[model samples]
Target chain A: MKTTNKIITNINQVSVDQVGIGDRVSRITARSVKNEAKIQGLKMALNMIDLTTLEGADTVNKVKQLCYKGMHLHDAYPDLPTVAAICVYPNFVGLAKEQLKGSGINVASVATAFPSGNSSLEVKITDTKMALDAGADEVDMVISRGKFHQGEYNYVFDEIAKIKETCGKNVRLKTILETGELGSLDNVRKASDIAMYAGSDFIKTSTGKISPAATLPVTLVMLEAIKDYYYETGIQIGMKPAGGISNSKLALHYLMLVKETLGDKWLTNQWFRFGASSLANDILMQLEKQRTGNYQSKDYFSKD
Target chain B: MYIGGKFPRTESGRYFTLKNAKGEEIANMCKGSRKDFRNAVVEARKAFEPWSNKTAYNRSQILYRIAEMLEGRKAQFIDELMQMGSTKKQADEEVFTSIDRLIYYAGWADKYQQISSSVNPVSGAFFNFTVLEPTGVVTAIAPEENGLIGLVSVIAPIIVSGNSCIVLASESKALCSVSFAEVINSSDVPGGVINILTGNAEELIPHFSTHMDVNSMLYCGDDKKSIQLIKENSAINLKRIVIKKDIDWMKDEAESPYFITKFTEVKTTWHPIEKIGASGSGY
Candidate 1:
């Protein structure tokens, strides 16, 4: 399924063996990170977090508190770095920007009928514009899973290109595949290639609203796609694995995967980020535990 | 059987048989391993903050509900105790006292703070006072004798003050502990708040004593070597260790507010006081 055209191509060329992917992920997880390397990995994971709060019950006060948490982390542990970004709904983008000013933390907003992407293309373009106009440093847009499922790869690619145009050059564009709903690892690999080829600065795994949100194997498939895209176009795409990553250990595994798959270029927050809310606190607790030589409790840490 | 809120057989799939007076195997109970104790400690740690943060009134209501549930299941408990070689009168008395002991601690839940706290007479212009707080997660070894009454006495005080516990039931008389776990399950007590494991104390106590996450240890047996082991290993984390022996739990003197205070930590606070109009103020 080769294409002579420059823009769209066949995703069927990307194939994944289900059993082999599982076996590789299991081996990756079994390799434990310990001692000095473990501490560094934990701190590095903490810095790459995109602290997020996307809920229907979200309020202005909650977003503001989350912004504060992004900068402060934990007062007891001094010299700790703040997270990479604070993610929120598009409507709260302006408020988060105002609250997080001068903190060097990016304000990321989820757009394009996020999580479902069931809205029309016109609505999705308007959603992207709303977020960008409100000073969002980054825009996370969801791909139309319905169109992709219906074998409308051309439509999916066109919509992503259109959204990238709406985001312009200043704001980073992240195309979420919502891999949990994609059914198979083979589909996840295809979606990653489609999003990256259609002009996305980042290819994210999920919207944090789906079960089996970001498994190791799914992320591995996306990482391999990013690596292959870099090889073909000499352009590096970022990766963010959102949801079900509530602890420090899993976050470390993700860093290991990114480093091994995409090399040292994607090791920093510029190319890799965790779209997680609770993962920050867990990392903070671990850092504190390492410093004090004792196990820390959630009571000592602040709730975001 | 209660590991993480649900009743499950031991992960090791090993059970110990209980013999009656005639040496007949009457029951088979789970012989929990180090893994089971570790799991219970994890659950206890998870349930600590939510259970400890509950208002005293709410905790009291839950304790009273347990007492109510125990009263309703009195016949089953008596029958189990009788099968464990307790005479009918002894079984009846144990069941009766266990209910009253729960009631006793239920009354103490809200009032223990008042009786235990105090405002200090400081020399400086500062208002200083001390209040008691739950000691996080605690692990207990239930007495081998008086299975019904002893289990209640050890658990009622620890939970009355809002601390969660992982109790290792008696090896010889283990039937009644599982029944109490059922009573706890139906009484609105949160899962993981009171985990009961039926196993040999010698096999499971070291894990309880050495676990870095557990904050306190409560042992009720008379085993000197096990107590020494608990003391030696608990030094790693400096856990608060309380060892009891030869105390008949069915006796009236066994129930006291001191037992509740034993599982609590006194936290003191100092607040600056502003002097007003040169009048001496007493708090």
Candidate 2:
């Protein structure tokens, strides 16, 4: 039998060495990918994106444009792959789903008092239910940082479990720790373990609303937790480093870190995803640069 | 040696030997590749907004500060000019001229926009006028002759208009360019406002012209083949290409408000006005 209960109980025992992580991340990022491999990495990163727009000002047209962008990406490059999914707020999930119909791009929605998990259990349950009812293939829920900081690990665990239960077996749950507020790398690792054992299908770094979002060092810590979880229960969990990863070169570095830490099995869209909006255009620009042998201008790319 | 706000070696790690008039090796200059040019353009683009948003008087003061720093290091520039085959008197003259050229451009910084802008009379109920704006980032190939004065002349005019620039220093006479970078660093001029690279103009000119992020290009040489290449590549982004051929930098005619206008774009605006009475609008 798997030792899920024991792992959850021992979450506090997981300590992250700040020095070791810093050195390893530097080494991983220093390994440059170039030429044909660079092109390949850029394409793979383009495919693994969860193009998100979760602003309070988001509208029907903006969500439609984002969904269209997810499918078309860049029509000039006929060989380009569409993004993995379209991420939006719950209200736009229905429209995004309608726009992305039959395009094979899943619709992900942020729910459960997203970016700030300050609501009650009933409110959180209703939030998840609203997203699922609107045809969200994935739900990105923020954990209760207030609870986690208060040493109420059980409350945090129960909240994620309740939302995962609402997700059923169909919808994947991406628990955003908002690592910028998590205080330390040790808390990040503990929070990763809690989300995984509480049945989160993906452990995301941030909600894109916080500073210090999804840094390479924090992503490494989460990946290590996922690796340990997989070794313990043989259940592989996905990783998504959302926010602030805008350029192609930095995206490649993240991919390198993933491959090195979690192995090749976690390299697909099903296992690894980037929750970013601007990252798509940048990757497309790099692909175009590789195709045309000239640096690209932002004027040519779409703003959405 | 200067990119972004720091002095860093070329990322390509390639170097070429610089020789004195006697053909003896003096120093190894960074053989900046297309990637270095690309990196500098990235920094220049990032630095454009803040640098351009600065008040004209502030930019004027910074340019004057560069002249002051250059004056303090006049002996070093004179020494480098002599190493590139100038006599003691010629070196002294070139250094003094370069410093004076910087001060000239500094004085022009806040005044050029006034002379360049114009009010136009339209045939409708509107006020039409035009004002000059910095043309984003510019890439230039410094003149091959008069090492220090030519570099100073090309750079001061372009940046005096609030445009950031990436300049390839004179290949044969590259020493003063590196020392000039030191002066720019110590001066109040912001980093990336002026990035100087030492490399072969022939190798870098194609990239300098074709870069989509660069808004304009300045070529100070008369090589027909290179000029043809620049004209062709600059078409990719429709970048404004200014070709200065056979210009003596030491002359008073070389430094003009027209030089600053070359790197500026005219933005014309029209504001609607209600007619007061049947007569034409009141002044």
Query: Using DockQ as the measure, which candidate wins?
Result: 2
Expressed as tens digits, the lDDT of each residue in B80-186 for candidate 2 is 98999999999999899988999999999889988989989878878899999999999999989878998899999999888999999898898888889989999
Q: Write the per-residue lDDT of candidate 2 for residues A169-284, one digit (tens) a residue.
A: 98999999999999999999999999999999999999999999999999999999999989988999999999999999899999999999998999999999999999999898
Compose the digit string of candidate 1's lDDT tens values, residues A216-296: 999999998888889998998999999889988899888888888889999999999999988988888778767765455
lDDT of 1 by residue, B173-263 (tens): 9988888999999999999999999998888887888767888999998888999999997887788998888898889888999999999
Q: Estimate the overall C-alpha local distance difference test score of candidate 1.
A: 0.89
TM-score of 1: 0.71
Q: Best candidate, TM-score-wise?
A: 2
